[model samples]
Target: MSPLQKIGAFGAALAVSFGAAYGVGALVGPFDSGSKSEAKQSAHQGAGHQEADAESETEGAASPVVPAGLQVTEGGYSLDLATTALVADRAGEVRFTVRGKDGAPVTSYRVEHEKELHLIVASRDLTEYRHLHPTRAADGTWSAPVTLEEAGSYRVFADFTPAGAAKNLTLGSDLTVTGAYAARQAPEPVREVTVDGYTVRLDGELVAGKGSELGFTVSRAGRPVALEPYLGANGHLVALRTGDLAYLHVHPHDDKAGATKVAFTADVPSTGSYRLFLDFKADGKVRTAAFTAGTDQHAHG
Candidate 1:
């Protein structure tokens, strides 16, 4: 079995445990021994499960705007992209709406992850950044106004968990800003170092000074492993700067078929190295993969 597969299996087990616990709690709610301590413990356990579910559901509660219901046509959700032209423009408001599986309007929902709906928007070149939440409208749509000063390819991520769901979901799509600007260059390659138990490969090339992508891969026992979902997703990645560990939470690009392969894109603020900790599920357990890489200085035309 590969690392990625292990991650998936671990996630599946966790989901089952959560479901079982939830079922038992619900069943035992009505028929209890009537002991005060037992009752209190039960209540506490119930609340803990709810809190866990909520936390799992809102793991990616930060990013650009994402369309509601982003699953694949077969029943999964997806972030739909309408355009890809990068240009400069004033911070204008963007409109969004959420519809149910049956195409009915959905309104008046709870905030699962952290905020009601976390919206993160950043240029593809990794220069601009904006985090905002859209206001819920009566028509079942969420709308938010934004302003941008640079022009480049941008990605909007919608981080939210539907009410009553156990896990959080993230949807991504591409957007383009139009205007005149200088395209930043990619960074130079830096030495690779290992952390924890997994081997990570880093590509330190930068697209712009502050905007760049770091590539990573995980392996064990000289073989690639399939990574499972840690919190309803393939893997969890957190990036922190060397000085203060300036925190940046990221998710895998997509799901993998086996354990050996995984990938991610990270944005940095300047030409420097950063520490990364990747949490992946494997062998029915969760493990942390770590690595460090320095940034290069190369502008994109």
Candidate 2:
């Protein structure tokens, strides 16, 4: 069976486990704060009526569902790109607007992680990725300078929260960079990768439908390196499912300064290969390290 199919089977088990009371967060996870809230509601509406059980739910045992970034329109918000095509290997600006359900551009937004909106663009093959903060205009349009190094299809994700909204949302759109395209094979799973003279090692296990803690340690010349804050955390992580590029924007649970290791809680939707990008600030410079990893090998059929 395919990984997705196995995930579907797990989804069924979840449905049965939470039957008649609440919903499973869809076959794939929805990457929005709203979904997390819904999951909490479901946990509260549990089958066990004991006071201890309810207290445990209140203490925040809410499972993190698989995140959602597979669609352009979600929860009445749409990622409307001004232009879907870009010239490869050329420096240029990418523009877009978030339209509300009333079919109008949304101007007001709630800042999350010190940014009004986070824009992530990645090649279809997961070989190239960019995390950018775009400039929003008075008319609700946002502009960001981007230079895609290669010509290929790309996915542009707009992750933000509207003003007074209860939860966050991540919407995705397609971008086509015109030119000769040659796809590169996705990299194999590796625990460590070096970028810009710094080596980062990953430690964790990803199980389908289960939340896991991922730790990343940075070092230089065999000595642990202290990390600076980036995006309100020691580091930031972006995980994309290899085949469909389902996106997850994760922030570390701890952000102690001078710490060499940063940790994040990740719960992917399915059992499959994924590409992870770690963006960290060190010595006043931001560098990104990429790694390819798969879910628990034992989970695969």
Candidate 3:
């Protein structure tokens, strides 16, 4: 089945909103190993998926802006993956370049979150995730060292902004790992999870199509622990949809330099299960806490 077919009508609407949020023309297929040209053409072909009447609706929390990491190319820029496959359980370098509409490597980029680009890798099953900062070379090619513990299909996202662009863009592609593959189920929803002797509890709810503020407190031994800054904020969050792994744009709110609790705001496009990954620094070391959350459809203001 095609990607749009799998997403169904409701998902297609959300996908349309995602493309529109960035002022793009169409929504492309999910992560695949297809060529960039093929994917771009497929996306334009699907542009008619959106109904003419839906255009009048306000593009706010009601529409739910589902941004980036779904298409390899968007808004005149494309993610060119030089390394598409990697070996399982082995450390290797992944290389790629950002090409503009003029078909030349884009070397100049605006720095955001203390880095020019942020790379995210997650398994198709949403079970494995990683956040890496890649170094850009003089030729505009970005390279990063990564190791995949398991063999499976993974989605690679390049989140960055070209010089003079209005906003950041996330381009996604597929990476294959050769070996025996076994899929794992997403964990059940939980309000609290423990990681590395720290207990992280999630407060607030995720309501679909509404801007939700999520608060997370880090504690150990029944006492709140102060958290240092990570990526220009007290904490960082990356939430992915359960089935298709749609990457949600999470904005971390700024707080005191070293506060015990950090907050974020995110708008999910639809009602479904999502996996939330929280990255925070404490005791001078960075740690990630993962949790599963679902939207409460009935909770609408």
Candidate 4:
């Protein structure tokens, strides 16, 4: 199964578990309602179930689901390229077509984040990455030419919301790039810092050869505050390797407010210095946090 499939499966399991728990709680509640103790227990149980269901639904609903029957076909919504396999190539072209869920031809799509659909391609090792926006063709195909100077296993993500849909979605696929192999190394430990009167804490170290999860918590006056949505997602994070500004586009785990926090899983190709930019809405205004991260050549520090 693909990584996307794995994520979908996990989400489905969580939803099912939440629903099952609610059903069990409701079934047991009526058995002993006459006793005051039983009534208190039932009330607490019901509230717990409701909260769980709400959270499950919110996460499931926000995720983008790729409908069945969509595939790469001849003259269809397919990616056409000289080589789907790449490695340290200075330049290449990715040509693809877009169709409606019903297989009907689609002419255009609304731009999200200043583009029709933002394409984020990155190596699995977190070394090489690129952010590009493709142009729509007359026939409904979107094409974007890219260039890479680093070698690694790359994944391409299409981030966009279907027209009329209330939420944004991310679709992912993997591509292989060939060249000299270099194992990713670990970076320094996470540290707490302050930015623009806001206290923020980073919770993960950077690694060069593998994906790393970086988490951030935002607080003001020693109390957590809700973070409003910026763009279509709850928060926006961008990472750039200091030398060349290699781009890494990361997404938040959830969108709800109250206690601002966002997590991003990213890969870096080589041991180097990287700059992270985090933007979120707080105090009725957009706030950005900047940090310099370093990845070491050894174990995760």
User: Could you tell which candidate, 1 or 3, scores higher by TM-score?
Assistant: 3
Looking at model 4, the pairs that clash are 86-177, 126-267, 126-268, 126-269, 127-268, 127-269, 184-208, 184-209, 187-296
CA lDDT of each candidate?
A: 0.41, 0.64, 0.64, 0.47
Off by more than 4 A, model 3? 1-66
Q: Flag clash pairs in model 3.
A: none
RMSD of each: 18.3, 11.0, 11.1, 17.2
**What's the C-alpha lDDT at position 243 in model 1?**
38
Where does model 4 exceed 4 Å of error? Answer: 1-83, 190-235, 238-301
Clash count for candidate 1 is 62
Return the TM-score for candidate 1, rounded to 2 decimals. 0.40
Q: Write candidate 3's Cα lDDT for 50-71 as tens digits.
A: 2112321365524333445778
lDDT of 1 by residue, 99-196 (tens): 55766655634442224555555554433445555666676666666676777666665555455543444445666777776775323223333334
TM-score per candidate, chains pooled: 0.40, 0.77, 0.77, 0.43
Candidate 4 similarity to native, TM-score: 0.43
1-301: candidate 2 lDDT, tens digit per residue: 0111111100111210100111111011111111111111111111101011111133667533334577677668888998799999898888999999998999987665567777888898888888788888899999988888789999998877688774566778899999889868676556677777888887766565555567788999999999987656688777777777877665566568799998766455456667777788787777778777666544421
- In candidate 2, the residue pairs with backbone N, CA or C atoms under 3 Å apart (3 or more residues apart, or in different chains) clash, namely 29-66, 30-68, 31-68
